[model samples]
Target: MSATATADLISRAQSGDHDAFRALTAPHVRELQVHCYRMLGSLQDAEDALQDSLLTAWRGLDRFEGRASLRTWLYKITTNRCLNARRSAARRRAHEWDIPGVHPPDPTRLGEVVWLEPLPDALVAGGVDALPGPEAHYERVESISLAFVTALQLLPRRQLAVLILRDVLGFPAKETADMLDSSVESVTSALKRARASLDRQRLSNPDREPPPAPRSRSEQELLATFVRAYEAADLEAVVALLTDDVFISMPPMPYEYEGLDTVAEFCARIFRAGRRFELVPTRANGQPAFGTYLRTPDGTSNGVGLFVLTLAGDRISAMTRFEKGVLPWFALPRSLPARGGLPGSRP
Candidate 1:
């Protein structure tokens, strides 16, 4: 992990030693992915950008004269790729749906913030292979929290990059300015604006601790109860687990139903359709999630939803339902077998 060792590995990697290349790059992969995610909020988009950046790095490896650390060099490539991606036709197509809710909610309660997305803490917590260095790992988890990322997404792209590089990643102002191709003063100004925007969006009820490591024992029990209640179409039991201010939002389709009563009504309506759900548990954004497959009225299971649960203390505070296409990202099947009996039925 020393500078000299890293330099040697980079040299070998450039010379086409695949193992050496991996050794040089392995330690920084998670962080790079996170950087990509910050630039592109969609997980899928981040993965694509990371792949593009890696390929570019490989192709240009021989040209790396090490004026900057290998890490900084890779980051430059990543940031550029993300910037290009943000200008692509596909990105343009995606933005058409960014404005959430065709029929705006009563502004008195939910406010106009739509376009919200979930981020699993595992992705941001440096994942399973994070480096052990304290300075490198410090506040990394907090830096990628849903609240923080959402605030970041609201900033102009250049400002977002400046803030992340200068504030969260602690890059020197000179280096950050160079990355954005702006003056140090401009970088400082952008960082200030970005911080102010984030301050305005800070959660009113911030957790006393870092968001509890996702999927704790309590979360598991609550998710189980949710699965049972939802699959059984038991409105009362399901309502019991929701916070008074629970919010449900389905993205790529902008209607946010808020409060336990409204959320319960939505669930009840779905239940009355005679469509049952099969919940497959997974983790995203450091929270409990289920790849939700729905059974048709005719009793055939088909992928229809990806449900991510957000818990504040013991009660469910939010449920985000993503489209079925997201099933594959969570490694879920397009469809499942229909239930032979009611939920909790023994084989």
Candidate 2:
């Protein structure tokens, strides 16, 4: 429907028409969920907060005032919900090496903040261009990237909200003020501080161009080689495919490996422990990803974790690994039947 049609739906919904509300909300769902994800850093939390925001919007329809567009009205609710959720965000600290049946090598250092989740780009397809304001400074896909989102998580809650609203979503400071129920001055100040903090934490991207979309011919070949080398246990081939300064990190567990030799050593430790992984092709945070299933003593491939790669030409520059609880979101099997469902895919 056109903007006029959407406005009509909003009007009807404001008058208590539930069907009109659903029609008006359909276009905004995906983007709203992503906003929550960026704010909360967890898909499950984002989904919950989005649902709550929708309900709050429905109940408070009459209070929307119509000064802002319906889209902005909905975002006001979502942003608030995410802020409340962030109040309880868990802090991850230095952890002792602890996997029951698997002995991983000692980590270089413990992670300071709770790890952020990777967003599936498919969930963000049309929602991308459809949401950004003409004035947005950051790239939408980069804003949702694992490194970017994780950096965002390090900002204080209010600063985080202001940055996402003003920079990422391209909302005006005045509109963000309304969303946060604060004055524009407060929003501006928060945004200033947020941007400065973010600048201090920003990761250097030597690859000037962004990564290609998932399943592109080049990405497919790169992913295939990575899987082959990883599965075959050929550290040399794997090393060849890695950038000279490649980084590997696992979130929520606080272990990071950087440089060729360090990453190789970390991999060697895991491989030495005899843990075999089968990677189910997937994508996340606008990059290539794999749902990894660790082979068990019973010969079944059990879900363990997922890793997404950052590419620079044909070499991988970074790898962000997330726990397997996100597999279902990618439509991957939790556990594959031994010798049958498992793809010869090893990563």
Off by over 4 Å in 2: 89-102, 206-214, 296-299, 340-347
TM-score per candidate: 0.80, 0.89
Quote the lDDT for 156 in model 2.
90
Sliding window of 10 residues with minimal summed lDDT for model 1? 92-101
Pairs with backbone N, CA or C atoms under 3 Å apart (clashes), candidate 2: none
For residues 1-347, write the lDDT of model 2, one tens digit per residue: 88788778878998999999998899899889988988887777788899999999999987877788888988888998888888865544444444445556555655655446778877867457575886577887788888888888888989999999899988988888988999999999998998888778756564534555557898888889999888767778888988877888787678877788888787777777776777888878888889988877666888888989998888898888887787888898999877743444422
For candidate 2, which ten residues in a row score worst on lDDT?
338-347
Whole-model lDDT values for every prediction = 0.71, 0.80
Candidate 2: C-alpha lDDT:
0.80
